[model samples]
Target: MLNDLPIRKIIHVDMDAFYASVAQLDNPELRGKAIAVGGGGARGVISAASYEARKFGVKSAMSGRLAIKLCPELIFVKTNFDRYNEISKKVRHIFHDYTDLVEPLSLDEAYLDVTANKKGNPSASLLAQEIRNRISTEVGLTASAGISINKFIAKVASDYNKPNGQKTVNPEEVLQFLEDLDIRKFYGVGKVTAEKMYQKGIFTGQDLKGKSLEYLEDHFGKSGSYYYHVVRGIHNSDVKPNRIRKSLAAERTFSENLSSEIFMLEKLDHITEEVVKRLKKSKVSGKTITLKIKYSDFTLQTRSKTLPYFVSEKSIILETAKDLLFQEKMSNSVRLLGISLSNLNTETSKIKVLEAKEKAVSVQLKFEF
Candidate 1:
């Protein structure tokens, strides 16, 4: 059955602890020590943690205070996005050397389709190694990779041998590999979903495969069909090179909670300005303006207004945000405020032309790499 599907060579490359690794690379003293990037203050959250810190149960998104409680000797470092972006570009340059079909998931990871590569190399496994080698030598960082027949398997396999390692799931190994996989390891299944799956006795891919499509749909809704097909190695989503941005937003977490609407206006004004600047930089506008509010109790609320036409000007965005802010009374003191624009004009005629050209490319069933 798998022999009938078109096979493409896909590789998922992920940097090892990117933010913390970068912090160590620039400062030699940070190497071999447990260091965390960001989350230095009383109200701070960790952005990333070094491997040494991981042993002490410290990780990204963990609160700084909690991280310190876990590892008292842990060091905190500031985030340098500019340096991270600079290094990301260098790594991307290495990817373009092999194929133009690179889709960046983030600064630290990406998906590369090397089915028909510039190198004319038949072995995708070797290509992955070459890319990882270049990143370590040229960029002074370590990376891990997963090479496989599709993006889904490739993504999961990348984490199999982490921290400067690689894994390849050949066409023949795809089925058994997926069957043995734990349900929690499935990309889209989060903690809540995993617990629900556990209740249904769907602990592994094989367990999930035992249920009928209707049963899965009845239990998991739209995601049910996805599980049914993926367990059988039937994921066909393409490695999209030009992923469109769905929305743009700017937000701030205030030092003190504001209890009055009058105090929120000034903060909203600054957020609106930042939103417009980003919209102009991306050369896109949107019809929907959403105001995100987080109360001191940590509950969240969102108020949105979709205009008749797209807007990018600060005056228009700020006015719309002001309207939403006062549309209803404050439930409690606000701790965070955000402004966002969606329904963007990014899907221009150029993207349509590219889609048309993409459809003309041919597919092959036999595995080449």
Candidate 2:
């Protein structure tokens, strides 16, 4: 039904090894080597590791001791989430420039609803390219993008190329793309799910498209609903516009350019305190810390880090942001400083989750209506 419906433009963005890549970018010594961010201690779990480290069998959530055994020279640095979180915000704002319909999957990936984009662009593929270019040039990070008529196909397209890559599935090409797709390549199709599909003689999208809706529901239960839509190459999910304010942050433009380290920290403390006050009133708890800086010549940068758990303390947020600021010596004077906390745990998000299910039903009802 979706394939037959009037085609709408969509884009999916996925960042490659975001945390580890950023570390390699800032520190030239770690580039092209098996670098894992975490400790070599017995309990240290790899928070993020470079692609090079992955080849050595290193992976996130794996123990550091095991990682070293895989790659003897495996470099392990303790995670500094304060920096990564800051960069997340910078990229998000950049995405907003193209479209307001952005659904962030995590710190590194998102789905963009670009059907009626602000840029007046007709081609979704061209829009995806422009967005990827801005991310690399403005944010100093490479990102992979996928463009298609719907979110499901867009997501599949983005991963076709690795870092700094993009691909598109236009209306005319959708059927061919689906015909050649492996069942495993479909998102949400786990190995177990794929094996089950294989049992049902479904190895590809063509096989899947041949199955009747009732037969699919009888075999796959709830997943049948998802699959029925996927075969047609669309995810009927809407981009949620209700952006719950997790952390309130403000940036002030300084009359005089400030270059001193102590000056930066002093400004950070003030901004962080403002964030904490908003968190308290909103009854929010977040462990991740983010810092944003704007240069006088208009170059912008951000850094952030996520903590093991949620915390809304002013001292903790400020300290984390302060560490990131100090890590990058402010050679050029900074014009503005801002702070925000993500991975936040709030009652608002909890409430929004409940609403999402109702919203999904409402979306379906719209078509029925």
Candidate 3:
């Protein structure tokens, strides 16, 4: 079965310290310094830290207080999504120059299928090098590239050499590489799953591959099938170029927490306006509205309501979000409020329909080996 699958040239490109790097690139003084990009306070969190700051154990999603304790000299810069988005678009344009089959996971990373790219370059490794060089020259930011036969291996290899480097796993070396890889390093195996695998004495890809298909299935359900095949160098998930946007959201944290319902309503209305504006800009509407609240005590709550029809107008979003907000009783003074729209109507709906038809047809074609 593995031999029947066609080989593909996939490349995963990831930016190094994207947010912190951009901050340094735009501000000369921040270059070569320990910096963290995010809010800095008791309620703040680090979004991204430069390599210098990381030396002191500062990392994204860590509390700002903890980050500061680790590196007192760490400079914190507020996030600028608009600026990041602009730079990300420029980076993506470079990818498009090579291949249209680019699947962006985020602003900082993407997977490219260059098996039949416009460049006519048969070497995926060389193409990855060219892409990295172009990004460094044109965008003034560093990126790491990993070239392999599949997306999973490419993504894993991209992280092997951090900051700025590239790794290529040739077709012949794929099995040996997979067999030697640590179970924790396999994509989709989170901390919990890794711990579970550890307890079961399955600490490496070889151990996982040794498990019977029935045993894996009994242990991990559907994911067991994934592990069963992936350990033997099989991952058929394509780099979907037309991945749909699941949701759109806007939120803000207040410097001073608000306890008054009137003040909360006012803030919700403001957030709703921001969300509606983004929806309009995206040219999409949704039937599901969600209201998120963060309290001064650091507790969080969310209320969501799905409507019968799609709506994107500011007034309607505001009214619906307000209703959802009021439905939940405040447990503490609010520090943050957010509004979002989901169940979006777009080309994604058509794609889903097509996929469903394809799946139905394939179900009848399936045969046991």
Provide the clashing-pair count of each candidate structure. Answer: 0, 10, 0
Q: Score each candidate by Cα lDDT.
A: 0.90, 0.79, 0.87
| Tens digits of lDDT, candidate 2, 1-369 | 553564566789998889898898789888899999875565466888888998888999787888899899999876665677788889899888876677887789888866666676667778888888888898888899988877788889998998789988877788779878999999889989999999999999999999988989999999997897777776766665445656656565565788887887788878888788767866878877878898888699988888998988887888888888887677588888888887777543345434543433343211100
Output the lDDT of residue 160, model 2.
94
Q: Compute each candidate's TM-score over C-alphas.
A: 0.92, 0.66, 0.89
Off by over 4 Å in 1: 347-368
- RMSD vs true structure, all candidates: 2.4, 14.3, 5.2
Highest lDDT against the true fold, candidate: 1
Superposed Cα deviation of residue 323, candidate 2 (Å)? 35
Per residue, candidate 3 scores C-alpha lDDT tens digits across 104-204 of 99999999977766676778888999999999999999999988888999998998898899989887788889999999999999999999999999999
The residue pairs in collision within model 2 are 81-304, 81-305, 82-304, 82-305, 83-303, 83-304, 84-304, 85-304, 86-303, 86-304
Worst 10 residues of 1 by lDDT: 356-365
